[model samples]
Target: MKLKLYADRMSQPVRAVIIFCKKNGIDFEEIRVDIAKRQNLTPEYAEINPMKQLPAIVDGRFKLFESHAILVYLASSFPGVADHWYPADVFKRSKIHSVLDWHHSNLRRGPTTIVRNTVLAPVLGRPLNPEAAAEGEKFLSASLSKIESVWLKGNGRFLLGGNQPSIADLSLVCDIMQLELLGETERNRLLGPYKEVQQWIENTRNATNPHFDEVHKILMKAKEKLQNPRMKGATNEGGGSDMKRTLHSRI
Candidate 1:
């Protein structure tokens, strides 16, 4: 069965899933959804994902959403590669699941909100409110401290009880990459306080993942485009004027 993934190139969760597929040698097709254009919100996309979120998938006739769920599904679907990435032991499996759940509720939201407010919004020619940016920074910094304490408590290079990478590492890597793309100033501010977290981020980035280069290239382009003022408004769909209005109104 051919797998089809609906994703935004800049979305960290999407990249995380893509990296998993690449590392496991899973064959799939990517269908880009331009969130800046509100493409995900359109009825056509809503039919596939009612929440209008990126990184949804269709494996043959079966449809799925949520990056973590997709990761578990992919691992179980290909058991040959499961032992290391998604262990079979009950306790080990539970540990992985716990971290993933925490990722969804905590780690994932902090850096993402900060990057969107401080980096993506301004690059898209949308004015960033100073107060919101400061709040995002505060939230993200606190989250990083917790992540360092929880995951980096041991001297292990990988998360959980393993020498090799697992679903926990993959999920965390995706979230960490968002902070890395936030320019030097913001990236340092977010990552500097947590020494262990910084080292883990580097380890994950250097690890072997089939989609590493492809995902990295996309992120690099996004960072570059966002930093260039002259190109911001012209590059985005509808010049991002409508998105700016929508985001600001929500704030």
Candidate 2:
């Protein structure tokens, strides 16, 4: 049986999986799970992924969640996929593993917290938390400094001192990309000093190509909507459907 991917493109990890599948030409069914609609909370999706996360997979009788694990599984299971993505070299693979493990607590925290508080909370009728967003920016700034000074220090164009991109590169870049949803001032404040990191993001996008653009189109669309004048007074109670429509599906 072909692999089955349950995903919603609005999610960073889900976008990583989508881009990986397209880049490697992996055959899989794309099942859309709209998180804004509470679709992932349904009993049907629970059976596939007990965690009820956005990006889960079914390979025959086996079930798996967690984006990093899924990326590794795809690389190992598919013989046709390029080797550089999840290298067989012991040392290189070890570096990739290290990055993936470090990502959850460090790199992932900033955007998830910032975006949740700045964007989603207001949209969901929750009280806005400026303090939480401020804290997220602090973490985000530190994470970017590490990426610029340490992770990308090597001569290779990509992470892990490799000529080609790896899952580590994809995972972190997607997380950072979430910042694009912020308004210009806030986005610049958070990302402006990370020139190396910004360039790396472009490199990753170029490497992932048409697929990256396609998967990320929703984010761009949402960003545009946020800039609209009419959106100024939009409230969670009154504009819930509009927010749902803007964020729910691929276009």
Candidate 3:
């Protein structure tokens, strides 16, 4: 049997995996597990992935979860993928490892929290969580600052001073893309200070063109919904069906 990928395009991590597979010419069946519909919460899906997250995979009898782990496994297990993605060099690969590890709490948490509170909560029939939003902003600011001062400080086309894109680049950039859901003022507040980070976003896009753009179409479409006044009003409602309806269509 071919590899099975349980994913949803609405998710950034899922998009990273899909983009990687497409970019590397890896053949696998793509399975959509819609989170907005709570499909992943089903009992059957739990058997496939106990954690019940999007972007799980079953390769033969082997099962893997977590986007970073999947990326490394694909890079290492596949025969012809580029070395820069999961480098063979001890130091370079170690740097990639370090970045990925740092990502879960720092880079990943920031946007997830912000988006969930600012946009997702309202759409889910819940009020915006101000405390959580403030916390997310604090962490997000720090993460971006580190990316500018530490990660991108190296003179390379991508992160870790490499000339080619790595999984880390795709992962963090996708996380940063969440800012698109914010209004212009808030988006600028979050992303404007990081000039190098912005440049890196473009470079990663250039490196992973067409595929990157293709995978992110869902997000691009959702960004448009944020501009609509009805959507904003729905979020303000404590538990509005319109908000759920909008999220279901877009998310």
TM-score of each candidate structure, all chains considered together: 0.86, 0.92, 0.91
What candidate 2 gets wrong by more than 4 Å, as runs, is: 229-241, 248-251
Model 1: lDDT of residue 232 = 50
Where does candidate 1 clash, by residue pair?
Answer: none
**RMSD in Å for model 2:** 3.2
Q: Kindly indicate the candidate among 1 and 2 with the higher lDDT.
A: 2
Candidate 3, residue 82: Cα displacement in angstroms equals 0.3
- Model 1 TM-score is 0.86
Which tens-of-lDDT digit does each residue in 45-106 have in candidate 1?
A: 99888989988999878889988999899998864675878888888889999989988777
lDDT of 2 by residue, 1-251 (tens): 99999988889999999999999999999988888678888999999998988799999999999999999999999868898899999988999999888788788989878987886665556788999988988889888898878888988778766678999999999999888888688788788888888889999999999999999988876776665637634754246466645553422
Q: In candidate 2, residue 159 scores what lDDT?
A: 76
Clashing pairs in 2: none
Summarize candidate 3's per-residue lDDT along 103-186 as a digit string, tens digits.
988988898789889876756668999899989999999999998888887799788777899999999998888777776777
Rank ordering of all candidates by TM-score, starting from the highest:
2, 3, 1
